[model samples]
Target: MTNVSQLARPHLRSLLMHVPDGILDAPTSVGTAVVATIGVGLALRGARRELDDRTAPLAGLVALFVFASQMLKFPVAAGTSGHLLGGALAAVLIGPWTATLALAVVLLVQSLAFADGGVTALGTNVTLLGIVGVWVGWLVFVGVRALLPKRPASVVPAAAAGALVSVPAAALVFTALFAIGGQVPVPLDRLAAAMVGVHTLIGVGEAVITALAVSSIVAVRPDLVHGARRTLAQRPLTIREKVPA
Candidate 1:
């Protein structure tokens, strides 16, 4: 005979700390959805080009891994928890285009099936976590990799840096959305400070997890790791050069 709201109180409190339903105006939600749809459509086309026989199965496995990782949340601050966004991890394991599709699938499933994220806010979630997260992480990874030596060992640090930066970037995106159509009346500066601050700490955890995962894959199957593939390819060339005429 317990009250339903009382029963759901704990869950609701935890849920609200992350993006939830009824927080943004209808116009904002719809606009985010339109943009997300276009991004996903483009990602789908791009993913088709990226996924070969070798990468297609790997892409599916990365999606499954990211989905599972996201479920394991850790406390970041008072009454707030954070989990792996997994965009950087996915992009490092597969390619950025496929990573976007994989992350979008994970977000869609989480929203529709588990009700982990808001159904109406699925577009926002996908846009922030899937599209922006993947691209930002991928770009950072590429930039960092370029600065580092062309070695398999370098991929881990680059992926970690990408993961570290992408979390705050996503938080900033949310802050921008709130400025547009947030249901709450909190001041923009205060909200941005809170969101970005918490996410920066969360990004530390993201960087560690991303680094560990990328390092493990590079150690075991460097050739299969999309981010390390270029470095791995150079080994054969080096061996060929060592063979004198």
Candidate 2:
């Protein structure tokens, strides 16, 4: 058997959201850029419907939180690490449309100011994280919430479940894209298995963070949680018949 220490290990890479330059071919890069642009455009239009004086500031705060949290990466596997995606958390706190915009802003800052993600691959990152992550998480959250009791507390678990799925969903998308136009030749099966496997573990952390954040907001002000709004609004009004007064 080959000694583990004797084997040459590749440099550790954080695979949660950041897609570096040159990993994808020109066609893949350009295609994703167009898709990301269109998605952001639609998000701009959709956000108007979701945002208001009350939720606008909250949106900013959610973006900031996601930006900060993503910087904290946890080890997932040998030569790989992951971080909080925050898509489900944002969607639950605000609305999905607004959450998409929030993620875009955070990604843009990370790409430009921090150089955390490549400029060439910014669109790919946005497509994977902003569009795929946000929508998948929001859709899952909605589905989960629908199945649970219509209450503010339900939003927490629903958000967590969504978060749990979103990370691996994004990873799978990346694997597909890599298979399509990966600069480096890698077997599809191995790539898919590795990406999905590591991300599934990352998803657990995502779930925990999302649940805590959602629960905190729900406990303090359930009305402020967009995902819980319907539950709160659905509370039956108590009507009492006045007897002999």
Candidate 3:
């Protein structure tokens, strides 16, 4: 078996999931920025319906957790690293609209404060991680939940499945954007293959973490888990009537 350390070659330690400033041409960057802006705008409006006194605190906690999780990186392949995208985790724990807004906030802070992603490439990161990641994971979670038995426990596996697919879906989107206006002249097929393959590995780790966290919360407070709410709500209420003694 290949040693894990051997895969950990030294590379620039910036956020792996985030696109840097110069990788994308100006037109591509600008176009993605417009799309990201529209997505965030929609999120801002939609989140109002998703957020209430009960969920408001959880949303803030989710954003904080995602921000911290993205900072911690692990070696994936030769000279490359990966970290939690947290889109599925957020979307499953909170609603998708609130999750989108939360991810946007995390990305913005990472870009501005930590410079983890580039200032110019902020929009691309938001589009990829915030919008695409959030929605795809949410949709997948919904689909998986529908297939499984309607129980609160089902949310754990469904959330994990969503987290697994979300990472690569975002990678594919990035590959498409890169194909359009990549600063470097790389073959599209090879780039897509590499990105999808590596991110799939990363997705496994994402799924595991998401499962653990979601299961823990579901065990303690299933009510707070947005994805599991329907399953939990569908639970039949039991009432006992005293018979004549």
Candidate 4:
């Protein structure tokens, strides 16, 4: 197990390096920056609400967990070992805004402190994994929830499907970014296809982890989950038994 883990790390880093430069455009960068800032603010505010009771500690734990998980890259096919893109799971377990903050912290730490990725490429990682991941995952979860029957059972599947799709969606975004400014010579079509294909398989792993995390939170503390809030009963109104006497 240790040998396998050790072998996979280099392959994962290589795949990340093959990614093209300047994929994160200025406009996209500004937008993600705004979203990420807002998310961090919201998380801090929410924590004050004794949402701290649930989401605060959980978010902290998840941020660290995600940061660590990304470090343990695993083999995908030949020279690529897939790493965790925790956007879907984080957003589903936390909220989109907060998930952004969580992932941002993870990415920042990975780049600055740990040097997992180059400092210059920080923007690319943030754009692909932080912004795209959260948006795609949150959108998928919301869409699936609307289509599926509202039940405890649906929660897992919704989270799972959302998680599964988000990885590929992010990969495509990265591919596009690469096409814009890739260093290594590779055709756009070939790059996009390879990225999307492998990441699709990788999504399964992401989805399973996300689903379990979501399911666990929903089962124990439904209020902490943004997606689950809809499934809950609204507060009843009782104004003097329907009207004033």
Residue 134 lDDT in model 4?
Answer: 78
Residue range 124-227, candidate 3, lDDT tens digits: 99999899999999999999999999899999999999999999999899888888988755566756666788888889889999999999999999998889
Using all chains and alpha carbons, the TM-scores for the candidates as numbered come to: 0.89, 0.91, 0.91, 0.76
lDDT of 1: 0.81
Each prediction's whole-model lDDT (CA): 0.81, 0.83, 0.85, 0.67
Can you write out model 2's per-residue Cα lDDT over 1-245, one digit (the tens) per residue? 00112112243243546887777899999999999999999999998988889888999999999999988877776766678888888988988888888888898999899987789988998898888898999999999999999778999999999999999998899888888888765566756666787789889999999999999989998988889988998988789999996
Position 111, candidate 4: lDDT = 74
Candidates 1 and 2 compared: the better one by TM-score is 2
Compute the lDDT for candidate 4: 0.67
Of the candidates numbered 1 and 4, which has the greater TM-score value? 1
As for model 1, its CA RMSD to the true structure in angstroms is 5.0
**Model 3: C-alpha RMSD to truth?**
4.3
**Candidate 1 residue pairs in backbone clash:** none
| Each model's Cα RMSD | 5.0, 4.5, 4.3, 6.9
Which tens-of-lDDT digit does each residue in 1-245 have in candidate 1? 00111213332223222366777789999988998899889998988877888878899999999999987888777766778899889988998988988988998898889877788888888888888888899999999999998899999999999999998888888879878998765667766666777788888999999999899989988888898887777755533346666
- After superposition, candidate 3 runs with Cα above 4 Å error: 1-15, 241-245
Deviation of model 2 at 70, angstroms = 0.8
Candidate 3 yields a Cα-based lDDT of 0.85
